[model samples]
Target: MSKKETKIYKNVWKPGTEDAAKKFGFIRPEDIIRKNVQKKPTSKIDQILTGWGNYVKSHFVELSPELKAESQKRLEICDPCNMRDRGTCSTGRQGAHVVTGKLMKGCGCRLAAKALSPGSVCPLGKW
Candidate 1:
């Protein structure tokens, strides 16, 4: 008997509350996807975070000290390794979400974790 292929359902992160957006820096998945479609990122996490900060700084008012502190704390706790299970090695497989139609692979951030609030930043671009 041959094993049948199992179907995987696409998992979508929905914002649970308005406060969740504030906690997670509130960037829409659509926006992220649009940016991704325009240009592929070839930088590492640190650089990406730096660029993100710069972009946010340019647009929004300077982050409050409290917000900055919180952001730093979250950044520190972010471990891309435990988010996904890809085998013995957890480094390469960061925030990979296997959904039914949409597939997000090689994403690294808390956005991939269930711990993140529904609307928490999705490290992966929109599907």
Candidate 2:
């Protein structure tokens, strides 16, 4: 095979895990293994309030053309991000600060609604 025809495969799971399971006569089911295992106490009230406020403003208030353009730009950034999962942001995956060069994670927000909110900010500082 030529260099141009070569393919590389990413090792996504633990080495020999599937083989070990098979040795034990078990069939492994396919699923997304989340890296963020330690659950933290997030402020439910604050999250709810922010989500509600964004919804109301985006749906009820008229957005200027510039604001709409900005929203679209934000969505474009979110579309191909690995941190996005099932139309929502996935937390705990490593990202970087746009300005400070600091490590960060997703904020766990619905992308469609968040993209429309003028006050909503990307956890990765993409916008």
Candidate 3:
């Protein structure tokens, strides 16, 4: 066969039977044998929280205990208010708030702010 014809035939007849097996939950003995391999357990929530914490830490400075407490209070108050008024702060307009420029501006998280602020006793780092 000509190269072009052969290429076309190969493309059209490419093997996709494994995909059908996957759809039907049919596993080859080799695959079953491989299943005995040890695998680490993954933590979905830990992964997500770790990613979020890292992102927050990268942006802000570490915080102090007092500041952390205040931020936590602010977050607690902000949560209900946000839920009532669409996921934002009510007073400062700085925490996912939609009204002011300061919206989404503050750490608003006790642990996060504590970890991101400069001179913070939080043990994380400066913002």
lDDT of each: 0.41, 0.67, 0.42
Off by over 4 Å in 1: 1-55, 58-61, 79-91, 94-127
Scored by lDDT, model 1 comes in at 0.41
Candidate 1 vs candidate 3: the TM-score winner is 1
- Candidate 2: segments with Cα more than 4 A from true spot: 1-63
- Model 2 score (lDDT): 0.67
User: What's the residue-level lDDT of 110 in candidate 1?
Assistant: 29
Candidate 1 backbone collisions, by pair: 9-100, 10-99, 10-100, 14-118, 15-119, 95-107
RMSD of each: 19.4, 18.1, 17.5
Tens digit of per-residue lDDT, candidate 3, span 1-127: 5687566544443346555554544544576466556544535444446535643755585645675555555445445443223432123343433433233533333433332232332111112
Q: What TM-score does model 2 achieve against the real structure? A: 0.50
Model 1: per-residue lDDT, tens digit, 13-105?
243453454345454567557746986544555445654554357366674566455445544444343444532223464444433345445
Q: Answer with 2 or 3, whichever has the higher TM-score.
A: 2
Clashes of each: 6, 0, 11
lDDT, residue 18, model 1: 36
